[model samples]
Target chain A: MSVTMDKPPVADGAPRPYTLRQPRLPRWTPPALALGAAAVAVGIGIGAGLGSRIQWGLIAGLLFVVGMYALAARVEGRRQAKDRLATSLVWVCFLLAVVPLISLVWETVARGSKVLDGGFLSHSMSGVLTIQPGGGVYHAIIGTLEQVGIATAISAPIGLLTAIYLVEYGRGRLAKAVTFFVDVMTGIPSIVAGLFILSFWIIMLDFGYSGFAGSMALSILMMPVVVRSTEEMLKLVPNELREASLALGVPKWRTILKVVLPTAIGGIATGVMLAVARIAGETAPIVLLVFGSQVINNNPFDGAQSSLPYYIYEQWAAGNEASYDRAWAAALVLIAFVMILNLVARGIARWKAPKTGR
Target chain B: MDITPATSAAPPPLSGAPAPAEQAKSATRPGDRIFLGFSRGSGILLLVIMAAIAAFLAVRAVNALSHNEGNFFTTFEWSANSTPPVFGIAVLAFGTVVSSLIAMLIAVPVAIGVALFVSHYAPRKLATPLSYVIDLLAAVPSIVYGLWGALFLVPHLGGLYSWLNDYLGWTGIFAYHDGAARSLFTIGILLAIMILPIVTSVSREVFLQTPRMNEEAALALGATRWEVIRMSVLPFGRSGVISASMLGLGRALGETMAVATVLSPSFLINTSLLDPGGGTFAQNIASSFKESGEIGKDALIASGLVLFVLTLLVNGAARMIIARRKEYTA
Candidate 1:
């Protein structure tokens, strides 16, 4: 490198016999060409009467990839063309995802805001018929809060204990069986959980549709999530903490309780919150188990109740303009609630993340 | 009494609290005993719940199946509430498989591409937010997706469906009589969008885990960036992508409201995916449950049983695939 530099700069007219030549496409060419391709694709889509933005995007994406490769092959070489194609395709994929997601959120906010004033949040559909316009998610919110609360109350402890067994005291067949089943349990569909509870609590035992019954199925869905997240958290806690507690002559259970749980509490809380968030938006279980009510029912055990997701489904199923408006409002509320929970959980997780500096 | 403190970092207490090695060593605290029993009970209870779900669903499904007048696998009509209760899963099973398969086909490629984009192509500053937005997409409820599909996407798809039918109508599958966009194809697209985030996230994680050393090795061998990815990254992530796709497939099969909202339900199976009316298992259960009588409810439960088994199999296979690759990857 030093010898080449010391020799001197070559003039433009020099033959440059020792120089290696590897021609490359200009950096801006791909993006410019991609933009052109996208324009062409959209024009074609419109001319051909393809309505969906998805078709337009797909066509644009294909054009961009192919165009990038062709331009690169002409300017540089085949290998370089392949490289450009991959990169452009990847960009197209990212854009394809971004478009729908942005549209979903945007569409929800725009449409939902029309009926999503304070009245919508504060009132219930007590006397409001399916076709009536004035209704809120108040009762549904109450039911969601209660049902999710009950589910969390039931699942968190059991899931925490199960994780503890798997991480700390687990051995042999029982532990293996528990771990395996937990994976299987993680895959159980929310509706199947509803059906399970339907058969077990409602069918065989003759329990009426109630928020408590919904809680039962929601707990089933929440448990494995809690377990997996808690297990990961517990695994993160260093062995030194447990060993230190034991060295101090602390009892095993006390060590776990005082040392392990506190240390991992942040992640555990995050996990539990995520679990709560998961169940809060669940419609299938509540639709079946709670048997959504139009009026408010404070008591979870005795009677049918309204929940946010169920209300949305019920309203949508009604198939009227007013009902559609209500469904959109409910969906908006549910999305906000779940998103808030997720953000908070993630915030707590990041904030309370264990320090590794020591 | 033997204390094995040297073997493990801490001495194992057979019970929760051991007294000592020399005197009354076998003695344990009752608190330790109770706590251990409680925790062990929780673990055992999970197993019990799984077992109970399977057993109960099996019993109920069998009871409903035995009472059916029509052939379970052949009949298209669902009339479990009527006298002589004629019903079958023929249409439901076909729709579920077809919609999910279409979902997988559409979702897997897009998801893999998105995963590759995030892990490989995107700038460092851009990648985090893109992935976070995608994660938020995953968090959005199925009901919301269903609403969007029904309200927003279906109408927009009319032109696309007509185009497909017009251009590719020679293929019996694309042939369409009506221009209504409420077909299995629409449901499949919605499901594809719905399942995209999970697949992308999983495969992104897997792709990111590809060893930098192997990537550098390819790069050092005069391979271009794409060649490096093809040689090292894609090979390493193949199992992960498969597992991710399977997980997405599991989601598509079991998804309820989205399919329920999008697809127009009918008893008959049509060859044209562009035509509406075939129903999926979860969708059928969800749509039928509210109006159905006791016998009809039982029938829905039976189909729910089938959906349950199907998801379990798909997820189990995914887990198995991931576990098998763990040896190589780790």
Candidate 2:
């Protein structure tokens, strides 16, 4: 090989005229490439078509893309095997993550649309039965709002204050201990929090099931999330502000209240909303503490009250098709609420982020 | 009112005169006293809430143990609704551990792979959209996951289950009787899917923050892309990987909806992963809490206490490891 390379170079000192023969195009490459591109185009066209027909398009598009890559590799050789493997794995991971999400949303919409009328949202399930399922989840919705409201009321202030302490005055052994325990609390199973509240309020204190106990349970779950997120947000605030506030002769607490918190208020609000969204979907704690009911209970301290999660559980677990429809509708409503909260938080955080130079 | 700097300055001089000589003599008074008082009081209150949660859980767990009719730890039978209410969380614990282990096994590698691809291999234009998709995955509620798992995944996994049973049944863990759609393996897979995006996003952010100079230096030294990641990226992100895994495990262990929807409950323990009756702690609590009698509820609470301890231990260990890493690096 070396001798041939040297001979060719020696003969072509002024650049050996390599013969540029009119090359015969390979039969397979063009057709295969064309077929792959056409397949992809047809897949996209079908996907854009109406209704259930779109699924075929999606499947076709996926297959076409794979086919295209495979054909390209066959023509190109095996040098890019690692890249191909990585690309395929990335898509596989994405599909694994996406299929369940799309399925869930699709199922929710398909089933919930049956019971998503004004009547379902407005009417209570007080009169509905297993045999006949015509009523709505109004009672459960109210219970969820009220219980979560109470939970937020209990958790937000304490969580924010504790975060303030951790960020501002966390210099000693006590702070270290608090930080450790908070981390531990952050990972407490929702069921355990429910159980703790159940044991304390119901078993230990002999109090009957109530929405208040549910709130307490939710607060336990919500507090650590709020504290951790708020602490993070607070830490992002610059120390210069604190120094400037102190230089102005402001008291430490007042400086924190005015300068530090306001600067991070947007992030704090987002964190709090995220925490609320988190606990709002919780089912276990409320199942143990609030105990689901059909009729709406106004008072947190009263008997069993329904929540959206518990309602979904009760309805779905009934095994009736109508009840299942109701459950799906309730889940849709719950998902809507959570998604809205997340969106609003994201919006606020984005809006409130400090303006920087372009 | 003339707000005079003169008055403020005068007061400081007088205060300073008394503070310099008297501060030495009465150092424990004034500002020091107030600061110490506020700090200690707030610190103690925070500590109390933390301690209270643990203390209350311990007390209730003890009460449950005393009232429990059977061996609390080892009994796989959950007959809490029986005449004597004989039960234990052994099955639940087993299911929890096994499912979480399986989820970790499946999710961590994929998550790290996704993270690496996004941080390094992906086109810059594609990174944002890819990340946004992953974030959306993280945002979908767990209940939606349950609904999806129950409706779509369970029905579709029948073929896969039969394949596993046929090929790997000798292992006992993958053994199946009649190849049912519902199994611990399905639950584990669902859990893995659910946690994948979370771990991926966190790990991606951490990997993106790895010092560019270090990565370039490795590449400049004739290292391949994979070698660069292995030598420069993974070591820098070991703590982050652990944290992400812990976070994913936290979600997995506490995940109620997906498990409850997928796994058929049985009290008896079986070595087969395809057994329809395996229960996790969260699943047990979610499924039984609604209709459970009073004693049954207590037993559920006791089981929840165990879950609580397990999560706390896992999270606490993660935090400790992270803190130690910070100390080591600093």
Candidate 3:
């Protein structure tokens, strides 16, 4: 009855109006038009003798954007059309950014699986030449694991203690200075980290190229990451827990050790794992310091060692089909390793989150 | 005696055990003192490492600069392995800045677009998963990006190269040389892609943090959705976007593997971006270090020092902007 009262005015002799007119564009219009524009783009690409898929994509994107804007302007008014245009542009930008990244991953997996297997995973490239087909990243994997493990070992205690200091005991100028420098260290290029180690350890101290040297640089890179994340986690732990623990007859150190660290352990672990993943894939420092070797050197302190990223770079630079395959396989392994670390870290974060009543 | 009448008024057992403990107590506990020492030592060690990085870099850089046969700042040639060791950072510095600028220019707008897509345009279900996927993309190693750029991107860009040169060739900057597709333009595109997730994620975070009350107020005034956003969200997030772009620039300036793999270097700077030759600092270091002698290594260290300072300044400025914004928001 209320809707009928607000109906358009009409004389008794005039024909009754049907349904009300809609002001918005149909919900399915954008996607349907996008598909049509893609067809048009492909057609024009073929007609105009453009051979690149990138060109085809670009043409399609432009067509879709223009087409959507024009159609929206016609059906809807100017204001709504402008809004639709902005929305369409945003969607298009997201798609344009996403497609290439997805393509990169697909290419890696599709090409990498051919050379990845148990045999590939277990063998070393020591006896194999660059032109041969029978070597794997086993040695590089060993080098990466040992180097990353050593870096984590060196960084975790220092990073953890530093976070504790900042969160619990920090007071004045020194804490602020530490915080500022940590920010700076976070932005240090990996190669610069390598250069630092190269200057102090290898050049001045007369040490040789070895996996240990790479670990030193990796630790420098890894420390700031660990400290930042751990500090964030420590900050998330509430003060009441500390107050309660101290209200007991417990010493302040014991309260931090027993209460604060326990409550934030899950997040701290996740942070450390993420830091490990980051340093694990670093190539610049390893290239500069570890100086990739074909042979598997188990002892990190003795001689040059191959790492996964360094291996990928070395194989790619070799400039041959066989070496390219090895590089792709190593890439696949590295991706898998990093992804696994990330997944486990996320899982731990979820599983161990402090319980609040639902 | 027993502190006179006060001890007698308290319980006998309570007062008996506490007297010795009170007499022996110091201002601070032993455990607390030891732990404080340990943590403070760790903090000092961090500062020492940072100071040492700067100190060592300076010493070596000075050593290399002193022995140079050519002007270290302006010479175009890099022949540190030669007898007199003639080398400089002129081309390297130019390539680093130009490529990174191009990267920031391209990546910033697209990233803002993508961020708006995730935060404002996409449905809730899609937005959550899309952000997760973007975060995953951020974790993909730079080496992987380099490999993909070398194998796939370089080949695919040839058509775009010809297209650009055909249309914009008169500008000289866009002119084609018909050589390897490896050029600074390609490096910029690769860097843009590498930094996209970082910028998008950051801007998305800021966009998501826009206050709901202001949004509702705009909507109550019969404003359209875009109008509400233009009135409130973008204004709120402008500094955040700037800081994010600076962060991306920092990454692009220091990026190593992708630039090295994608660009074929030459000593001379060509105005044509479609031509294949320019070198970034990180790339130059990575490529030249393998065969360098002692002095050559030191010269490369000097360049690394430059890259270090550049990134530090950019990051410091970004942090300053962010910190100031925090006070403004409060």
Candidate 4:
């Protein structure tokens, strides 16, 4: 073992000079480069009279990436340099996305908080002029509630049944076609649905504008969402449960009704509510179909009606400071309503997830 | 319910079913028959609705198109309510496509990065809440975004537009004339923000689903984290990312209130994106609905048909990609 090879590569070496560890930049290198890049960007911005902080930030981001690549390449290797480039880009992307979203929420809350009050909530824009401040979303809220309620009532059962058919009984070409069309249905723009109802309900049948027409369109939008979500939940039900019920001489329909549905009921309710939340904020279809009214219209089947979203739109279109305040306030209420529904839907999913055992 | 049972019973006697079929059918009770019929009918009803939407829209669109004094595809002016009812979709098509193109250009790469950040880069503690925030962002309704865009984003974008014009005005697209910052470009940015969450969520799911073994093998070869992702994750999720972007594009094309709120509608197509004038199909429809006559309403319906078909193609292609990817993975 100790026999000396005269031409050994490591001649006269105590231990090969090579080390397993590569020469790595210090951990502080990234932050240091970022700070230097920021300084340079600020300098360039001031010198060039840049108007937007966005431009400065973009320059700083670019400089940081370039600097990081150059530094890492020199100290470590090209691979590490590329990795640093990717890391920086990903971080920048996250920051870019976060900015607009935060601004949206913050602006809505800040501007909207100015006019939102009990009086604003309880009164209607019935007698008030478009440019004045004295009005509320009371009628709009009622219209939205009734229209959305009817939409849910119409769509939920049909959507649920469609899902049940797809998951439980779907087999051949008809099922496949239904599935494909349902996917396509989910992509129908709200306005197209409105146009469909408009042509059919008003143009063909000669009915005037009513909230019922809007509800029909909203139901069209809600149906596909409900079907998709409900189908997923239904597919999660255990086959063995159905088998066990069938073995006990329970009819197949009864097995589905009494055994399978109860198991998935929590998820089904959540899906329907989420669908409701989705349609509740739709404004485009309502503008065409409902023919928004300033005063209360309790009967959705009657003349023109306004919903919360339509109210915000109508107010904003009025183009006055007072109208803008009302729009913002209504927007705040709408957002709050939507956010609560989302939270509750997710909460229900979390709470019921354990019982499903998947 | 009783009517359904009666109809089912009526069908059985005429078919003259075979023995095993009859036995099997009898084993299933009337309740099963009715339930099956009802659920199946519901599925058929959905198909019928889709067909009706297409058919009815076509009928109205054709009626409007026939009466038009101007070329439906080429003419720029829209005076559908006027005598002879001249209207066309040239400007609306340009605005819709250009705005959505800008939206796709900005949104797709950023969405992928956000997806990667959530799936790989972020700390575990940060990732959960970050995605939650994104989900909330998606749930924030479009009208709220419109309000924010008009009041907050439109005002704030003046500086950025000027900066862009200063550097890139020679390109003509970025040229700004110091007008209100409610151009198609502004709507593009707003649409990008709106579609970001959906794109991110879809891409994140695909990225997360990349096989653990492939990633681990790359890492075992002394690959850095980013290298591992580039080698193992991105290739697998490429189609997913494409489909996600297409889905986002579908959304951007049909988006109504946000664009309607932000863009100052005019019938002319602007060479510079920084200009305040131009219209989208959906936006034109919404803005003109109030002032139009019956012919105008039909003309708006005609425009909606174009949006509907365009979105359908985009979404259909996206779904095909997803379906193909599913087969490959399975």
Q: Write one digit per residue (lDDT tens) for candidate 3, span A82-183.
A: 777888888889988998998899989988898999999998898899999979988999999999999999999999999999999898999988988887
lDDT of 1 by residue, B152-247 (tens): 888888867777888998998988776568999889989999999999999999999999999999888878888889999999999999999998
Local accuracy of candidate 3 as per-residue lDDT tens digits, B98-181: 999998888999999999999988999999989988988888899999999999999889888999889999999999867669
Interface RMSD of each: 1.3, 4.6, 1.1, 1.1
- By summed lDDT, which 10 consecutive residues of candidate 1 chain B come out lowest? B18-27
* Model 4's DockQ score: 0.65
Pairs clashing within candidate 4? none
DockQ, candidate 3, comes to 0.66
lDDT of 2 by residue, B1-330 (tens): 268878766767877577677546544546645654664565466567666667777776676666678998898788777777788888888899999999999899878888887888778998888887777557666766776677667776764555567789899987777644677888888999888988899889889878899999987975546667878989999888898899889889988877887788888777888767789999988887767777787677778777877887788888887788768767
For model 2 the local lDDT of residue A104 reads 72
Query: What TM-score between 0 and 1 does chain B of candidate 4 receive?
Result: 0.93
Can you rank all candidates by lDDT, best first? 4, 3, 1, 2
Task: Give model 3's docking category.
Answer: medium
Which lDDT values do the candidates have, in the order given? Answer: 0.87, 0.77, 0.90, 0.90
Q: Considering only the true interface residues, what is the Cα RMSD of candidate 3 after superposition?
A: 1.1
The Cα error of candidate 2 at residue B218, in Å, is: 3.7
* A258-353: candidate 1 lDDT, tens digit per residue: 999999899999999988988888888887889989888999998999899888888888999999998898899999999999999999999998
TM-scores, all models, native as reference: 0.93, 0.84, 0.93, 0.93
For model 4, how does the per-residue alpha-carbon lDDT over A150-239 read when each residue is reduced to its tens digit? 999999999999999999999999898888888888888899999999999999999999999999999999999999999998888888
Question: What is candidate 2's CAPRI-style docking category based on DockQ?
Answer: acceptable
* lDDT per residue as tens, model 2, A1-358: 2353244335544554555321222556444644665576566555654223324334544564476457545533332323344555555455555665677778888877887988888888876786586999889989999999999998888888788878887787878888888777877777777877777788789999899999998988888888898898898888888999878876677778888889899999999998888888888787778878988778878899999888887776786778878888988898889888888987898888643323
Return the candidate ranking by DockQ, descending. 3, 4, 1, 2
